[model samples]
Target: MDLLGNGPHVRQARRDAYREEDSLRTRRDRFKGFTNITTGSKGEGLTCCFKSDSDVMRVIDNVMCVEDGVNCNNISREITFMILNFRYYYHGHCKLRLGRRDQFIHPFVRRALWNDEYLSKE
Candidate 1:
């Protein structure tokens, strides 16, 4: 099975593997950059009114930046989960859960991160 260099399929497979690896590497780098900015190590100028490393700050930005036709309310659920995960990691429990989806998402987002419930079972 000297397929490594002997067949077009093998060559295509190798190309596909290389492309996948490259894509993953690019995504990893992009995430690393985001992590740096969100943690306040970079892009500090992008945010105001909240601590740079606050996950709530990132969630607010992301909610505000969504494209038209995409419902920010719907996406807020996911963002709530992200914030909750961050809280659970840094602290021991999530003390926040988002309000009713029918209400605008930004108000809840604007509330202090530590003082709200964005992912409560209710």
Candidate 2:
């Protein structure tokens, strides 16, 4: 008999519990105008064994990232655009700079700007 209860059924039960918890957390974040994207071991439903830390990425809904050469003439005025500058970094990583001078700057991003330039992934 399995005294420790470390069988396949037990493992699957743990994963299902963790997944339900994550779904609730994600729903809460959505109400706050942010999307929670889970990653790492805990996100993959591997919480049956060793302890794992939760890694979540909260993406803001009002902020938008666009390419350096993309035309923003048709974009909504309420959305804040962060122009991606690829010249300073390699692929898959880039620095987020402010868009056109006429563009409206969100208060949150405006407070973090350094000389009208946003933060980078350096």
Candidate 3:
């Protein structure tokens, strides 16, 4: 079958021709897929990454910290993001609760971050 002879052949050829061009699109899709995970984003596609559950808890623990203490770039990344797992802090923050065996739901994990019950001592 010639590359562009029949209708089906033409369609297949077009798909194949664009596959290379769609590499960037494919990467974007895979990147977007990461948000589907519990350790991933629970809200919309747009998000700002935090450091750790404990860190988030620390901020939420203090209503004042949540406001007067800006958690923006001004704050030290090491202090704001110092989590139980150094590896996770080094890599990327996930939804794993410290000293627990289960993975909490994405939203709940985010919520637990505000709760002192889930906060790690360290």
Candidate 4:
């Protein structure tokens, strides 16, 4: 009883589907709290941006890569992880309200989030 039937194209498509599913899962797990993701040009190359939603006590680790987008460099490496300490200065503490999921983050807002000192404490 071949539930998936039998065809070269069918098998290839199924494999591709599985691969895509796995890739999406990897991104989701790697960037659990991230939301309102979008892609656009940054300087000269394309970039992906999203707001994380982890609580003040959560630890930030791991570099995240998104589908059809560039790798996140600023938050990709090791840092002291001071989001909790500076949570009060930001609006939602940990829950970044990024508006529509399709809308790219504003340049000013992105710059604010990507602030060097803030991103890499200690």
The window of 10 residues in a row where model 1 has the poorest summed lDDT is: 35-44
Q: For model 3, state the Cα shift of residue 26 in Å.
A: 2.0
- Compose the digit string of candidate 2's lDDT tens values, residues 1-122: 14665556666676677667657877877767776665666555555445767676777778899989999888887888988888868778888776766676677677778454234321
Assess the local accuracy of residue 21 in candidate 2 as a C-alpha lDDT between 0 and 100: 68
Per-candidate clashes come to: 7, 0, 0, 0
Q: Name the regions of candidate 4 deviating beyond 4 angstroms.
A: 1-4, 32-122
* Candidate 2 local lDDT, residue 117: 27
Off by over 4 Å in 2: 1-23, 29-31, 48-50, 88-93, 114-122
Candidate 4: Cα lDDT at 44: 13
Predicted candidate 1 versus true structure: per-residue lDDT over 58-93, tens digit per residue: 222333332223344455543432222233345554
Better of 3 and 4 by TM-score: 4
RMSD of each: 17.2, 5.8, 16.5, 16.8
Worst 10 residues of 3 by lDDT: 54-63
**Tens-digit lDDT track for model 4 on 1-122?**
13544355554554454445545655676646323221222211122122232121222233122322233345423321122222445664443332223334444444656755433442
Ranking, lDDT, top scorer first:
2, 1, 4, 3
Per-model TM-score, in order, reads 0.23, 0.62, 0.20, 0.24
Per residue, candidate 3 scores C-alpha lDDT tens digits across 43-98 of 22122224223111111111112222234344332222322333434456433333
Candidate 2 lDDT (Cα, 0 to 1): 0.70
What lDDT does each candidate get? 0.39, 0.70, 0.34, 0.36
Error of 4 at 59 (Å): 20
